[model samples]
Target: MSDNVSDGVSSFADLGLGPELLNALSGLGYEEPTPIQREAIPPLLEGRDLIGQAATGTGKTAAFALPLLQGLSSDEGRTGPAALILVPTRELAVQVSQAFHRYGRGLGVRVVPIYGGQPIGWQMKALERGVDVVVATPGRALDHIGRGTLRPQEIKAVVLDEADEMLDMGFAEDIEEILRETPDDRRTVLFSATLPPRIKGLTGRYLRDPVQIQIGREEAPPGEAPLVRQNAYVVARAHKPAALGRLLDVEAPTAAIVFCRTREEVDQLTETLNGRGYRAEALHGGMSQDQRDRVMGRLRGGTAELLIATDVAARGLDVEQLTHVVNYNVPSAPESYVHRIGRVGRAGREGVAITLAEPREHRMLKTIERVTKQRITVEKVPTVADLRARRLELTRAALQESLMEDDLSRFLAVVEPLTEEFDVMEVALAAVKMAYESSGAAADEEEIPQIAPKAADREGRDRRGAGARRDRRGGTPAQGMTRLFIGLGRSAAVRPQDLVGAIAGESKLSGRDIGAIEIADRFSLVEVPESAAEQVIKALRRTTIKGRKPTIRRERDTTGRRPR
Candidate 1:
């Protein structure tokens, strides 16, 4: 298989796939092959052992799946699964099994996904009845092999999807055991995001004279921009919820996945977003398998527009309509960042990756930028004025789409009578007003405060100053108290009692823990124990002080000023 053959091939049909597979591809609306698919399909079809370096959402599943299906026997005499795919997570097993079913539907392919969450009895029955393909996680697959249920010797081809992830998750011994059960002559294919040394060693042991294919990261050509629009917003932790709401209003993604760090955060953020009028769902390891399935169904069915999930829970999710990936906080690692954003900008579709970073985490964002070799532009959170403009723009776009696609003949009579009685412009204005109101546009919202980016040296100095202060006090400053700035003050009829009551009522903090409170006309400053700042901010956002949600954040002072 040569590059010329891969490049010259345009469609699945041209790759020498059978009519059944090609027909299925057509029904799925797959017109052409992705870069990975284009490069990896040819060698695979020739019964060659292949090592492919590709990321998720690169169409690698189908690249190998199509060839495997094409080589399978549709006859009834085939006693067991001829193809086996090993994935790191149950979610991925299900997804890959579904793909095999879709592509081999015309040929009556019997595919089963075997994982721990599902009933073993069901899997046992399916295996007894016979299957052409089995997509499974390493642990469950090893269990079946041990129970004499799944016969690896019957498999003619094997695929290790996300091999690197499986290795990282401590599946090396399990994988080795499972492979040992399979025939030595079986055609093996492995796909990994990175070619780590462990992966190379696995290939060396299992693959013989393999065709190594490396799909480089998709980079923007010189003088051109990348496909995924990456951007970050620096926001105080207190104001992040409001800032997210504002950005969502402006971006208005058709579907999005918002990644959180913990199950509690997922639940909290989902509740907060729902209260703000978003159709949001929460997913985490705490939920049952059935619960996770229903949440996924809602997201896929378009009933939910936002999915708030922890990183572990969202692995192997593939949603075609997903337009955005929102990071509630900066990812802990550069690889994590890569995987998060890889869920979007798929199949050459435009996508956006938004990160809400606190001032202290700005350096982590830069580190991710360097490692990924991509630029993430720092953007300002949309203000109230920007939100209004965005809402109006959305309204305008809605009207334009309606004018082009909708049948408005039935309403013409009403408009005609109104135009006859008054001017046509007045009639139009009334109609536009009605449309705007029905669009769920917010009638009023206060401006979200913005923070200036700290200089490099200033940030370093701040960290050192905090450490020194901790040393001098024999503990943290103010006995580990952090001062927070509230956007409301005396001008809004706000008082120290009002602030104290609000904080106490919403957050876990009591009035005793609250330190000095200073009231100013434009803004107010209050001191709270450092550990409770996040909880207080989240609670206050859910409630209102003086009948309004004021911007709240930890106070950052470049000038030398001690807390009162």
Candidate 2:
């Protein structure tokens, strides 16, 4: 282990990784391991039971992933899987599997994601083909065990990712059953953001005198806090995307972190940023660690300046010179907002923190301010005129930088001929204009709008969408109504209140627009007014209930498989 780690090692390779895994890590440009990786790797590599405490994005995934992959059997397994990793949700299952695949690429490891909502046929086939590892959600894994579709007897190791969340989602017993099924000799590794009482008890019961490792919070005392200039922009819900892009255009940050709420949002915004001509990289739980490292590498090398990522996905990211942090949407909690802003303004460097707020989220902004004791200066969305002026300023800056660095002697030769043919100043201006455009220094206005406003936005929405009533507002509904089918049901242990909470909370939908909810053992159906159905779907897509996604669609019938 490296001494800089405080716990030990300077490099990931020194921590006893296999040749192939080390080579892969090097290729990803990961020269040094984070603190969590430095301490956890050696102990886990020795096949010892361990308990790790770390925050999200702290590079904890790699801490366990390397050791878990290292412990795969030298001989073929004789059971369903050699290793079983239990995650709180399907999204995490995919994330962990991708990480393992990336780290073990050269080892020909057969790792697969096994979660519910996704079809079971694929996982069954993978299991039959001899999978080396399995990443699954507790409910789905229990379903497989009940159907006699999986056996954990040959398991060499078991990892519980986000153990706290699993307990929160009421998966403690399910986890115990899966762990008990595995052979007693199997290695155990448990990770949690906080070891609540339940997590502590589980560790006591399952892990055999585990080696405990904790990387505590990194909170700076009051007077020693960072120097981030906090500010926010208010816009309508439909116009936030445009607002974010416009702000980015005017700000013209060299490198920035855009915090999105979900993995799906990360991918979508990454595309949007790229389309705007920014070298953007996507970081999410769904990406493999190698992919993540590559994204980080690009950001570090100045190949990509914008990183679109979720809070959990960006955990443990220590980019040395980030200039700004943009909150695409306000966080659900004030603490998270603080953490997101804390990513920048580190080490006493000047930084900017910008937030894009929907009309209703202004309240959230106030709550955040009160909690952090930081005033978020409210500003109107930048106008087209503002963007144009900013672009011109950037153009002038480029010319100044050029004047200081390049030899004007060669360029003057070409300019002198033009000057002889035309007005000297006109010729020089035209040359500079051509130089700026050719370098693509126009503030990326092609994708982001020049300027936008709020009052006009409400008018536009009224012209398009139906006049839906806001139940939370004590208003009435629009003429028509809509119904959606969510493929989670009572049998899957879903609840109507959970559905209502997810929809009303994430979207602009009011309780009235969310008419009725019907839940069955295998599925559930919901009624939402037509005037707001599209918005409901969009919002529901962003929210997560019981740590599982609820697929929302037009209700086909009262009775249908909705095949959960």
Best by TM-score: 1
Alpha-carbon TM-score of each model against the true structure:
0.71, 0.51
Consecutive 10-residue window with the lowest summed lDDT within model 2: 468-477
In model 1, the worst 10-residue window by lDDT is 467-476
Model 2: per-residue Cα lDDT over 1-564, one tens digit each: 122333446887688788888888988767888778887888888788989886655678899998877766354535557788888766578778888999989888889888766778877777777788889988888888777777777777889987876886688899999888889998999987667688888989889978888864343344232345676777776777767877776565657999998888888888877887778999887877568768888988877879999887775366655767999988887757756776665433446789888767877887887866665766557666666654554455345434534588977778877877899989868877886676555654533232333454445334433422211111122346555656566556564457766887887774434554444434555667677777877877777667877666655423643322
Over 1-564, each residue of candidate 1 has an lDDT whose tens digit, in order, gives 235557577788778888888889999999998878888888888889999987677889998999888888444577888989999888899889988989989888889999988999999999999889999999999999989999988988889998987887789999999899999999999998777789999999999899888775565445333556787889999989989998887766667999999999999999999998999999999999999999999998878989999988897788877878999999988877877898887765556799999989999988998887776767678777776665564455445435544699999878888877999988878888887777666643857678776565345334442212211111123657787767776568675568878998888886556665555445666778889998987887888889988877666443533223
Q: Each model's RMSD to truth, in Å?
A: 18.7, 22.5
Per lDDT, the best of the predicted structures is 1
